[model samples]
Target: MTMEFGPDDQIDYDGPVTPYRQLAEILRARIARGDWAPNRAIPSEARLVQEYGPARTTVRRAIKVLVEEGVLFVVPQRGTFVAERSSEDR
Candidate 1:
């Protein structure tokens, strides 16, 4: 199944892979493809759970990895978002 990481890196996951990594890959692909522009609001953990059918902790772990990698950022209440990092930052 093809997953589309939309403008905000939200995905329609349909793979047998581990959900958290799948989720991370979706975000990575979106950034690589420029589907998600820099500094855009990414889907929240709750939104991701709904989309990926994963546990909250799993989603949070995926997001945390992205944040650590400079692929995403978390703002209190505002939610996670795509970070505007240059290629060198990756």
Candidate 2:
């Protein structure tokens, strides 16, 4: 289920897939492509909103999905970041 998405990919708001899930896939693609390095913080929610034209809640939902999949993690006050992958994961 690996989809190739580029950095300039735009969201299909009217498509069958939910906006949040589309965003999650886009972010996952970016991470897989090394747009964000391991342990590096992703852009803030506000930035994602600006870039993706999704509401804050939508962005949060996307991030939550990534976190649940172990693709990302969050710090209490810092920010969300790309999770470090172990050898087994690679």
Candidate 3:
């Protein structure tokens, strides 16, 4: 059960983990690796679906997890952005 992730990691559909969880881990790694700066918007849901070959629902679910974990935030029509680090995260 290796759950570790890092920048440049790709989703392995053959692995034990579900695709949505893999996507969440990948997104987390991307954020930690500075793929997108805090408060910067990541790619849109449609783009993510096209890039990762996941269903839109799966992508949304992964984004929801990051949002709940404070790693990302959504601005309705604007799109999802990386969250500002709290004092604790710093």
Candidate 4:
């Protein structure tokens, strides 16, 4: 499947990219496009699962990837937020 997401909300279940990876890419793009501002929460894991139809583990994995890449940070019970603005985003 030669699929490429183009700033869209739908996830291609039959595409080559795994659901978790696709979700990660989608979120990174969203952040870059300023859909959610720095230090602001994006969406809850349950919300993501409902929106993207992925498993909780998949959503968590995608979140983990972003956290590792410094695009997002978790605040215990509060939830996940976009990373603080940084020169790296420049």
Candidate 5:
């Protein structure tokens, strides 16, 4: 928990989607597969930046989309967490 992304966040950037959107999709799939449990902390902005090579705003946009889509929840002083059983994801 050094507040860094490292190699794990690095992405190949495939397809027509923006890097942030692609990152969102990647996180979404992981959540759907139980890679991240509900209420668990998702990756941080610094990590995402290093991994996706995108601006903070772009990453925020992608995350915002997920929040709007009901795939994530933000807890004060904590962090973003995967929503359990989001209907939008189904």
Candidate 6:
């Protein structure tokens, strides 16, 4: 099932889920909705922090989770990009 998030969606700081995990899910939904194309870099951590009102560390943690899940991949000097899913990933 695909999950989608709208522009108005905001992270619930006091919600049961941790902020990092919530940010991760929001990003996952954004990716699934094609906010960023495959292999295209996502917004920088600073931009995300400004947009999501999360701390820099929180944004980094969310990105790390996506990377570990193969949803994203980071290029050291560049930035993070959406992973191009293989047929086996379906």
Q: Judged by lDDT, which candidate is best?
A: 3
lDDT of 4 at 14: 86
The best-first sequence of candidates by lDDT reads 3, 2, 6, 4, 1, 5
**Local accuracy of candidate 5 as per-residue lDDT tens digits, 1-90:** 112222234444664556666667767766766778887878887777776687888788888988998889888888888887746546
Q: Mind giving the per-residue lDDT tens digits that candidate 2 earns over 1-90? A: 445456668888887778888899899889878899999999999999999999999999999999999999999899999999878888
lDDT of every predicted structure (CA atoms): 0.74, 0.91, 0.91, 0.88, 0.72, 0.89
Model 2 segments beyond 4 Å from truth? 1-6
Worst 10-residue lDDT window for candidate 4 reads: 1-10
- Candidate 3: Cα lDDT at 75: 99
Better of 1 and 6 by TM-score: 6
Off by over 4 Å in 4: 1-4
Q: Between candidates 2 and 4, which one is better according to TM-score?
A: 2
TM-score of each: 0.69, 0.90, 0.92, 0.88, 0.71, 0.89
Name the top TM-score candidate: 3
Pairwise TM-score winner, candidates 3 and 4 = 3
Position 40, candidate 1: lDDT: 81
Clashing pairs for predicted structure model 5, backbone only: 9-51
